[model samples]
Target: MKELLYNLLHGSSTIVTPMDALQNMVIALILGVVVCITYRITYSGVAYSSKFNTALMMLSLITTMVMNILGTSLALSLGMVGALSIVRFRTAIKDPRDTTYIFWAISIGMGAGSSNYYIVIIGTLFIAATSIAFSFSFKKDNKYLVIVRGTNECIEAVRAALFSIYRPCKLRAETVTDDYTEIVYQIKLNNKDQLIDYENIKNIEGVSFVNMVARDGETLG
Candidate 1:
């Protein structure tokens, strides 16, 4: 078992064998598959971009290939960097998490390609577990900004009504007008089932109208 493990880690350096190249390629392919699967399972965004996901998988495989070639020669490494630097990516990333995933995929590929298989496996597993933990935690603390617009006479009534239904709400901002008033609330709630309850608020006496919007922890304009 020790001999087998040593052979896998050190690799055969005497001759450039087809079997060795094939083994490296297979390892890279497996790493790519793992990355792709993890990304798919952990994704939480509103829309899932298959293109981006596919790009991540390909990046893992390609980066590993590049690292393998570069590992063989310093000259090739420099040339590879030059070639990659000239390539421009114009796509705009909406979520900050997407950028992190890109880096993770690249790291996995480079680690495996350089024959640091242990690092690649352990690092990927660690990152994946951390990401899943964070994702679930964020879901629990879901917050939203609520904007309420009504008449001056109804301002207090509005505040009282909102507080009665949704506890732990904070008044973020307020605007006074000749006939109407606009107030914003930073509300942290346990569930979204109470969202439609805002309609009852609009029915309050002296209230002209009530507008409630859901924001992901951002101030409502």
Candidate 2:
């Protein structure tokens, strides 16, 4: 059993030539860009992160390099597994679309590293086309959490202003204190341009503040 394990670990591995390594890396880079661009094009989130987008691109390159190195040796592959097992990723993925992009980047890297050009090319094109189609077909409404703070006397006025400017406004929360009232509304807009009336809402009399925060579509209600 010991001898078999040793032999398995030290087995004859595929040799990677310099030209092959360069080709794999270049392909991975190109695929990474495609993945990044696809994510950017289909993304409909308030928190559009450039850092995460750049990470997606780099992740493909790094995965390709790791796979290339691992392909050349069985013992090193085992070691890499052990090393990676010790690392912990604490970052949270706020959107499911971002998770899809992450997986796509990794898959592209693996395919490129294994020199599966046809599968990578065809699969990428199909996935990108599908994503674009869905993005256009079922458009999403832009959502915002509108917070209004004002004196008790302005409660009616605040409601009037919100209802006049934004329709279908759902009240998320309402807190009435002895001196003031705080109202939170979840408003949906067909386009982001509809939020341009913020200054008008802020200028209302007795209104302490009017703040709008871009938010996801999900709600507890």
Give the best candidate by TM-score. 2
Candidate 1, residues 1-221, lDDT tens digits: the string is 98876564445433324665566667767776776777787786557888888898788888877776666554565577899899998989888989998998889778877778888888888887887777767754456677777778888988987898787889999999898888888776666567667668778787765555554333322
List where candidate 1 sits over 4 angstroms from the true fold.
1-21, 90-94, 137-139, 151-153, 191-193, 204-221
What's the lDDT for all of these models?
Answer: 0.74, 0.84
True lDDT of residue 158, candidate 1: 83
lDDT of 2 by residue, 74-138 (tens): 89887999999999999998787788899999998889888989999899989999998899999
Model 2 lDDT vs. the true structure? 0.84
Query: Runs in model 2 with CA error above 4 Å?
Result: 1-7, 190-198, 217-221
Candidate 1 is scored at a TM of 0.73
| Number of the predicted model whose lDDT against the real structure is largest | 2
Lowest summed lDDT across 10 adjacent residues in model 1 is found at: 212-221
